[model samples]
Target chain A: MLKRYLLSPGPTPVPEKVLLDMAMPMIHHRTSEFSNIFKEVREGLKPIFGTRQDVLILAGSGTAAMEAAVVNTLNEGDKVLVVNAGKFGKRWVEIATTYGLDVITIDIEWGRSVKPDQVESKLIAHPEIKAVLVQASETSTTAYHPIEEIGKIVSLRDETLLIVDGITSVGVYETKMDEWGIDILITGSQKAFMLPPGLALIALSEKAWKFTEKSRIPKFYLNLKKERKSQLENTTSWTPAVSLIIGLKSVLEIMNKEGLPNVYKRHALCAEATRKGLMAMGFELLAKDIPSNSATGIVLPEGFDGGKFVKLMREKAGLTFAGGQDHLKGKILRVSHLGYHDFFDTIIALSSLEIGFSQFGLKVELGAGVKVAEEIFKNHLGV
Target chain B: MLKRYLLSPGPTPVPEKVLLDMAMPMIHHRTSEFSNIFKEVREGLKPIFGTRQDVLILAGSGTAAMEAAVVNTLNEGDKVLVVNAGKFGKRWVEIATTYGLDVITIDIEWGRSVKPDQVESKLIAHPEIKAVLVQASETSTTAYHPIEEIGKIVSLRDETLLIVDGITSVGVYETKMDEWGIDILITGSQKAFMLPPGLALIALSEKAWKFTEKSRIPKFYLNLKKERKSQLENTTSWTPAVSLIIGLKSVLEIMNKEGLPNVYKRHALCAEATRKGLMAMGFELLAKDIPSNSATGIVLPEGFDGGKFVKLMREKAGLTFAGGQDHLKGKILRVSHLGYHDFFDTIIALSSLEIGFSQFGLKVELGAGVKVAEEIFKNHLGV
Candidate 1:
């Protein structure tokens, strides 16, 4: 019997401790017992988001929270600037246009991050734009954008709000939402939170809260204003993802015991080792500049079938890695370093890649990649 | 240590087998393994919903599906008739009004079900009503509506649809959606599904599909048409609650093994035993006419302090029961037999209620309520 491992960008491996904690008998959410847990989990999320504002927990996927961010702060016909860098960036445009917002995009190549100057120039060109939408890390391309720099560019304009989708970045790296002038920040539970999907955490600045007063988007389930009132009282506006919230409390405790700084450092080491090991094996990365610490996208060698490779890895080796989407399909493979992953996981990924390349008729030295990864881990012993 | 028991209607206790199944390591959603499970779960939900139509699984609470039922079928400025019998029934009116629908509600008392004749007359008077929104079992008041009779009336008109919120009744009772001509049916995972409160299941009729083509409500997250296309291919449009869906598969298996009819009989037996036991103890039921088989609502004696009774049962005796909402607050108590429940659970509830009564300074004959419950159980041995 072959054991299975999940190495995808999202739906990463959940810790056994967290899983067993969630497996306990269900409790009523309205009771004071659950209220205490909710209060702690809500407070625990703020430091990771780097915010002082109340973080609203929603009972949907990351996309639902992304939709909430757009509908709750903007009205029909409101002009907005979207940074179209990858799949998730394009999502912001789709959500904005669906709500009747006139969108002006700062388009960039799929693997590269948008320049801060480009956003500033777009704001200058369209002063009527009411918001600048972007991503902290694009999961599709494995690229990390300069959110702090972009936050500065948008902060100069009082009328424009800065909205950042930090789904893959919040707990993986440092994202100071308040200090960086980010008006709104969002993340999902399946990413760095080391849990299953279904819950999304979002926070809004004082400035973003002011926009809701004048916004005219009609909503009920995703209404942030109503949710804030309930959340402040240690409850959710709707029936929350209760089991996930309980799992969240345990994960936060785990993260707290390890210290957030060390958590970020561990992710950094895993990502760096994977990237360095792949480079040593003569493979190129999709994200040439500013690679994200959450996941690493590798450019498959010529004549290699990525679809077949991923399928074989999953079915034969019982290892799950993500293949590319859209145009990058059959050309790239993405392996995640986010959420409950460590150095050994990185070593296993590199060793498998070495074997996969050999099976695909490519020349590869045995243990070449793993040796480099081992050296990196050995150098950073504490991490 | 006090062993806590959850007897609430919504967040009911999940079976240990289902909980353990969910505790297994997480898997990627974009794989054949997950797709196969999803396809099976979707197909499994059809027999329970009693519909041949494709049932869509959403990753939010019950209210999200209620909103989806509205935004997908009817457009802005549409008029709808809502049966406002209890708290959840009032929710339909609130959701419809939030999305610009002109709501005309047939207001009824808290514990009484809406009359089918009244609904027929309302539809006859207002032919412009796009839909008749209602609930199969009102959890707040423990009342069950006559959905089949109302469905027959609504089916006679091709222009109007009948939407039923079966959050507490679908698996607890036999709801033949296709036979009864229900256009849209909705339920949550936490209630009769014996899981947590993250996933909502919805199914739409062929006639309801036609309504979506002409509807013009702006939506993105709760877009049912987009979700239907993806769900047909054994996937979801957004990230689903993977763990809860896995738990649903196990619970459905348990139900299938017992047979759906037997499951319904179990719920009916538990509900009847609860009602009879409370009646034997001289407590009046809130639902005087047609009480739901999901839960039993009891009216406390004069100056009995229902809130204090419920609190003591929870804190002191480790038994959790729901207090009355709205006007019934501090005057009634609700105990559930919705999912993963049996006759013993009813006996425990009755025994505790008897103890709580005496502790709260009301004279209660010990073993009086439990004896009637035991007699009922003995009479229906196979169930």
Candidate 2:
């Protein structure tokens, strides 16, 4: 058997403990044992989301929660402003449009964060916009938008709500959902939760709750009001993914034991080390301005196939990095340091990248990248 | 640690092999190895669904697929007929009504199968009906509807589509999608597939495809057309619950090895033994006519509390059985025979029930229920 490492942004490496937790025997969803676990999980998610609001759990991928946010707040033909910077940002616009919302999008260049000025201009021009949707961190392009600035702009209007896609940013970076006036924050269990992708978590502010009450959109299984009612009693509106919930409960305990500040600091140190290592190897970073701290996207050298490079790393080195999507398919490679990662793992990733580049006919110095990464690790760890 | 057995209809006893398979290292969703496994899974599901059509897999519970079926076929204000017999049947009606569809429900008594006459009468009375939805096996009440007869009636109208919820009945009982002329069939991985819940599988016939082309309902994450387009090349429209997919692939391989007929026979034998055991213990069955082979619903004796009986079974005998839902709560106990159960398992379950009844202060003979179950198993196994 080959040793494999997951370096994707969203479905980052899961902790060994989480896997063992999932292997436990399945429990009945209606049992009191499950309700106790569910109650703890709900209370645990509040601080991570940076809010005092109740967070609802759904048994689906991140997109399911994203859809829940849209359907629960917007009615047919309701005006909304979407900031499109990368694949995920554009996905918000697509989903909103699919639900018959009148979407006005502010297009930013791919691999670049959405400018606060641009978002402000869009919202000012469309005063009828009921909501402003943006991604805190776009995983596809590795761009992190300025949520605080967007939140400031949206808070000026009493009727406007700000929705944030925190799927890839929740556990990696700082997200003050309540303090920043973010009305709806959506995330998933796969990315920074260090678990498999079966659970989605969403927290809604009072403003968003009011919008939900007035929204006339048709929904059933993902109905937010009904789900919230059940959550108040520490239950789900429907039969939940019970095994995944157990896994999530275990991961939540681990997160609480390690405190949020230390977890955030560890991810920041790993991200900085990875970036410094790539720079030492003469690789250019994509999203030079306002790059995401969760994942670092590097541009492949001229005439080097990014897809083939990822394949080589996966097959030969057992390191699975993500290739760029759509237009960036053969142009960039994304290396993630989101969850359950450390200094040693960063060193291994740099060594694997060096070998992969060499195999792809790009000249690279052996152990050069690792040396830079180790220095950063030493400085961060003060060892 | 106490040795426990899961007798719930879903989240049933997962095979040890499937659990071990899911514990393997995670794979990148975009890699060729993962795509190869996904392709094999798609091919494997066709025979299980008994359809030449493609089956779309979503990373959600069974209700998500139920929502997908309704949102993709019926437009707002469209007339639809929902045959309600049990909790799941009523759920379909609720889902339809939530989507702004004009739902005409044929409500049947709980624990009884939906009659073909009611379906025909409703259709004849309402020629404007565009779709008819029903459950093949209501897991809540343990009743199996007359799908073959309903299919015959619905096939007469070229415009109206017949949708069947086969979540708990697909692999446990005979469900020949193409042979029965079922326009749409939906199932989940947790039930008879012997895997944990996360993945929902749905297949569509030509009539359902035509309905989708004109459906005006709002959808994005559960959009079947987009899923079908991506699935043509053996890919998902979005990030899938990859670990569950791996577990499902392994479980399907095991099913193929055992053969579908053998799996069905095993479920039938277990169900028969359970029924005999319950009868010998002098307990009345909730589902009087057309009881499902997937599970047996036993009505408690006079002055008996269903919840307390279930708790006694769980704590003392280390057995977990599903209690009644909604109106049936405290009236019946549901014993599931679906998914990876055997004759020995049936015997153990009966013994546990005998212990539970004795603890509840009911007079019952020791080993009598087990003896009856063993005899039934012997007759079925021809030993």
Candidate 3:
């Protein structure tokens, strides 16, 4: 029997405790029992987001929260700046344009992060820009954008809001939303929360909340204003994803037990090990300059077939790694060091890569990658 | 220790087997394993919706699907007809108006169903009416609209679509979407699907699909056209609620094993028994003319505190029931017979109602309601 391993960036392995907690009998959302849990989960989310504001839990994917951030904070025809660095960053452009926002984009090359100067320059050039939409970690390219720096640049403009899609970066690294001057921050449950997909957690600063008052974009389900009012009373404007919220409460308890700082350290060490292992296996890294701690993208060789390699790794080794998307398809393989992942998972991934590469007729020594990953993990102990 | 029971509409009790299935190890969404389950679920949902069309699965609550129906089908400022009978019907009007639809509503009494002649008259008066939005079962008042007659009327109009919110009706009764010529139908997992809230299943007919082609509403998260294309390929446009989808597969399997007709019959029997029990206990039902098979709403006695009564039922009797919303608050109590419920659950509800009523200084016989419910179940056995 081939035991499967889920190593994708999102839909990460769920902890048994969280799963069992969610598996318990369903509770009515309007009851005190549910409200109590909702209250705890909301408060628990603030620390992860590093925000003093209420972290509104939406019953949709990260994209839903992203849309809410756009429509609720900006009016039609309002000028917006988007940093289109990768697939998710491109989504910001798409969402902004869909809402009739005049989108000015800084299109960086794939596998590269946008510089703070570029955003500052765009803001200066377009003084009417109301919001700067960007991703903290572009999942598609595994590139880490300097959100803190960009937030600093955007916060200086009283009319501009810094909206960060921290779907892959929030709990994986230090995402100080308030300290970084981020106006709006968003993340999904399937990412660093170590839960299955569905729920999206978002927090908006006082200035961003003010934007909702004048925002003219028509909305019903993803209405952040209604959500905020209900959530403050320990309820939701709509029926929330009850099971996921229950799971989120348990996950927060787990995070608290592990300590948030240690969780970040663990993810950092795992990402470092995975990177070192890939380099030792004679692979080119995609985001070498500012790689995200959530996942790592590796450039495939000229003749390598990424689809076949990923399929073989799944079918033969029972390892699941995310293949590249769009232009990067058949060119890279992304291995995640996201939530519920450890150093051993990185070892297994590197081992599978080495074996799969050799099977694909590449000159790769067995255990070379695993050996290097083991060393990095060993050195991290500081013994 | 109190043994809790959930009998609220829309977060109805989840079966043990389905919960256990969802508690299994998480799987990556882009994998073949997940695709196979998604494909099966998509097909399974069609039978429940009673449609030959592809039923799109979304990772949000029922309101999200309701919003999708409006945004994907009608453009901004388009005229639409809403049958405002209860809370859910009001939701259709709210959603339609929120998306800039010029809403003309036929207001019905809180617990009364809307007449088909009124809808036909509205359609006849305003041929420009783009759609008729109504609820198959209005949970707030336990009212069921005549969707079949409304569908027949709307089907005759080439330009008008009939959108039915079947959140508490689809799996509880015979909806027959295609047979009734419904343009768009929507339901949530928490209600009759016997799953936790998160996933919303929506299906559209050819006419509604045509409406999407000319629609100009700005949307990103609830984009039906994008979701339809991806769902046809056994995937979702965005990350789905993975664990909930897994549970839905198990739920479909259970429903199929029981047979759809049998499932509908079971819900009908339970609803009938609940109504009889409440009546025998001297409680006046809110919807006496045309009641919903999903839940039953009973008007509270004069000078009785509904909030206190509901709390006592929960804390003292280990039973949870829903109180009315808005103007109906403190005047009604809604007990659900939807999803994963049996005749015994109705009996339990009736028993609690009798005890709670007697304790509240109302002249209620201890076993009056339970005796009636038990008799109904016994007679149904044909012994």
A best-first ranking of the candidates according to their DockQ comes to 1, 3, 2
Minimum summed lDDT over a 10-residue window in model 1 chain A is located at A374-383
Residues B1-383, candidate 1: write the lDDT tens digits.
99988898989999999999999999998888889999999999999999999999999999999999999999888999999999898899889988899999999999998889999999989999999999999999999999999999999999999999999989999989999999999999999899999999999999999999988898898999999999999998889899998998999999999899999999998998999999998888999879999999988887878887788788888999999988889999999998988888899999988887887777788788999999989977765
DockQ of 3: 0.91
* Clashing residue pairs for model 3: none
True contacts kept of 2: 0.59
Complex DockQ per candidate: 0.92, 0.71, 0.91
TM-score of each: 0.99, 0.98, 0.98
Q: TM-score (0 to 1) of chain B, per candidate?
A: 0.98, 0.98, 0.98
lDDT of model 3, residue B280? 90
Query: Candidate 2 has which clashing residue pairs, if any?
Result: none
Q: In what order do the candidates fall by TM-score, top score first?
A: 1, 3, 2
In terms of docking quality, model 1 is: high
lDDT of 3 by residue, A1-383 (tens): 99988887988999999999999999888888889999998999888899889999999999999999999999989999999989998899999989898999999999888999999988888899999999999999999999988988888989999999999999999778999899999999998999999999899999999999999888889889999999999999999988999999999998999899999999999998888888888888899579999999999989789988888788788898998999999899999998888878888888888888898999988998898888878866656
Assess candidate 2 and give its TM-score to the true structure: 0.98
In candidate 2, stretches whose alpha carbon ends up further than 4 angstroms from where it belongs are A381-383, B379-383
